[model samples]
Target chain A: MSFADVNIQFLEAAKYTLGLFFLTLLIAIPLGVVICACAMSRFRPVKWLANTFIWIIRGTPLMLQVIVVMYGPGLIFDVPMKNRFLAALIAFAINYAAYFAEIYRGGIMAMPKGQYEAGKVLGMSKASVNGLVIFPQVVKKITPAMGNEVITLVKDTSIANIIALPEIILTAKNIVATYAIIWPLFYTGVFYLLMSGVLTLFFKWLEKRTNYYKA
Target chain B: MAFYQVNNVYKNFGDVKVLKGINLELDEGQVLAIIGSSGSGKTTLLRCLNFLEIPDKADIYLKGENIFSIDNTDSAAASNADESNISEVENGKNIQTDSEKNQPTHAKKAKPEKISKEMRKLIDSKRGHFGMVFQSFNLFPHFNVLKNVTLAAKLKYDAHAPKGFARWSKEAKAARKQAMQEINEKAVALLERVGLGEKLNSYPCELSGGQQQRVAIARALILQPDILCFDEPTSALDPELTREVLKVIRDLKKDGHTMIVVTHEMQFAKKVADKVIFMADGIVEEEGTPQQVFEHPVSEKTKAFLAESEKSIDEE
Candidate 1:
């Protein structure tokens, strides 16, 4: 393949990688927040359910989770999986949300109880206390941990190739197979590196932005 | 005829009796200071008044309105001691005739409704009526000093504003702007009053212990509460800082604000308090005017505690 052809092809595949990454984050972060809230819920049954879900997701490997999520319905229920993109998206979102929920729980748990008490004594409603005082501090605390997970997510997108979902690495492998060119396969590393580098920069900016809250 | 009364208050924390049948009456513009050794239930009593620590049974009455009774407006219905209500006082001291004395405590009436759950919530929303300053200050560390002082006031205003007024009406928006201007101006003045005007932009962590406590005091005062409760507000401060905080509190006393202060500062207590309550274990051991309590304490427990406290001061 010509250099320009390689660029155009890689860019087209980059779209899928970025789409999976963004969609997973868009779905997972809010899902993670809800899960974290449930995990810390006052209701014992809800808390237990959330904890059990987190334990199951965390104990198993993400690769295995992705495989099972993509194929488990087809294998167990005898229902053929319809959409490859939807399968990949569901697998990634579920796996990442579990990890993100734990990070959120840690952030929420680390805050001083005095913050809530102070908010209450000032006549703030329970919801207002969480939104105005507690969540901002939690967000500041979880940023570094979240940044690490996000960087890992960039690389984990490559695992989608196991199910023939053509993201960046799969496209590279296709090029190597068709044209018998070894260079494009190595060029794929550059794409992952650049994506992670940009994400690292973005996360660094986020951490700085939240520097106003000191513990 | 008292402005406020904590009648037959009791609290237990998992079998440990923290407050046992505590009773006291407070007058308007009176500053009552509570003093005791550690674990003496002074803080618990303050918390009970604010409903921060829900007492097992407390009949808190403000201007003869049973604040913990369900229907405070009906004097006939106020016989159900445990029911609660929110009484918003607006410049009138329409002293209801004291009917509580005539109602026999043992008179068998239909069982009072178990309204503690609903009353707990009702009392909680009325907590703004009692501003509290903790020993540790407990200022929101995430907020700057100005935000810390203004936060509760703004939220309270927002909460009490007619529902959806801010979102739907131009008139409401104009009113809100005017209200916000007044809040900010009042907040600035409060910060200034606490000697923290120059530190308005400083974060809680950036301020010293005394400065943070002053900010906390300002935060509490912004609500313009009916009563200000201090849980050893200067306990965490050094002597210099303690003096600064005490000076501010003294100024508040001069301003005729009703206050309930729990303090180890006996001199400050004696100087500022209209009534001094000396508590030991879980009950009031002795209480009187500051002169009688400090100079002629009736109980051995009060006398001993005062002597020990004075010895500690001498050692310092």
Candidate 2:
């Protein structure tokens, strides 16, 4: 193969990695907050339901959840599932939402209860407590957890290839299988390491910004 | 109606009885002080006001209406079962949301419309009408002073309590606007009152303990609440810093605002207290004018308390 073809292949793989990283984030942050509300809701059933979902998600492999979400409707109900990209998105959204929910819950619960009562006597309601009193505090509390999840998500998205959704690792593996070369596989690590490193730096910056909450 | 009254309140956690037949009362324009040693249920008594934890048995009144009704042991379990069963039986009859489980309990007791609605109406009235401060300043760590002060205006004062009520109407817009204005003007004024006018934009950590407590005071007072409860607001401060906070409380008293303060400052209590209550073992052991309680203690507990607190301050 020409050197130019190998360069193009690397570019193609970079596009896939970048796409998955952005897509997961675009879906995860808000969805994680929603999951957090469900998990830590004042309402009992909602909390129980959210806890059950997290328990199931954490207990099982992400690989299995990916397959089930991607293929379950078609396999179980004898109906065609949506496009592979959409299935992958749903699987990723749901799986990460559960993980994010736990991060949020942990962050929120870690805060002193006095903060909440303080919010209350401040005449803030539960929702206001969440938005004004709690959410920002939780954000500070969860930055590390969120940072970890986001980094892990960068690597986990490669599971898209199980159903042939064509992410970075898939791009690398396919090229290596055909060309009798392992450079693409090793090149895949560059994308992950770079993304993870950037996220780590971003989180450190966020932590520095949130240091006012140290009290 | 006195703004609030807690009559014959009882609270027990497992085998431990925290508050036994406690009585507390606050009127529209009075400063009632609850002073005691630690673990005396002073905090628990404060918690009961908002139903954060209900009394095991009691009659609580707000605005002359009965707001708290304790359960008889026989009916407590029965009522709990009936509510759960009613929902379980009705679960198949209609759509259900995940949050239905924590819906206000009054809905299950009387007519779905009458009693529960009245109960909610009563609870909603309490919102914004009263405010509390803690021993620890408990300021929102993430937000600046202005946003923290503005929270009641944007969220709770304008928002209804005992939520899940139907939406307010177009006619209610004026009330909403009025509430908004009250929250804004009053919060800003309160910040000024607490000497935090310039620091409105500052975050909690940027301030000293005295400054943070001042901000917390503004955050509490913004709603124009009928009563402001300060739970040992100065305990966390040094003696010099405590003087700054006491000045603010003194100003509030000068303005004729009612208060229920749990304080360790005997001098402040003696000076500003219209009535001083000595709480011990979750109940009032002694209560009278500050002079009567402080200078002439009636109970052994009160005598011991005055002796200990007075000695420590002088030693320093």
Model 2, residue A199: distance off in Å is: 3.8
* Residue-level lDDT tens digits of model 1 in A1-215: 98788878999989889999999999999999889889877577998999999999889887787788789999999986887777888988988999999999898878776687788789888789889998889889999999999999999998888888888899999999999999999999999999999999999999999887576
**Over 4 Å off, model 2:** A28-38, A41-52, A67-90, A161-165, A197-215, B1-6, B25-29, B57-121, B154-185, B310-316
Tens digits of per-residue lDDT, candidate 2, A97-118, equal 8888787777766778787667
Give the interface RMSD values of the models in order: 10.5, 4.9
Model 1 per-residue lDDT tens digits across residues B1-316: 6898888777665556778888998999999999999989998888778766555566777877766632222342454345433343211112322221112122114222233434546777678679999988889988999999888888877877878634558887888889889988999999999898899898998989999999999999999899999999998989999999999999998898999999999999999999999999989999999999999988999888888876854575
RMSD (CA, Å), candidate 1 to true, equals: 7.8
lDDT of 2 by residue, B153-237 (tens): 6675455623333335554666677777777777778899888888877888889999999988888776677678888899999
Query: Could you give the DockQ of candidate 1?
Result: 0.34
State in Å the error of residue A182, model 1: 5.6
Model 1 reaches an interface RMSD of 10.5
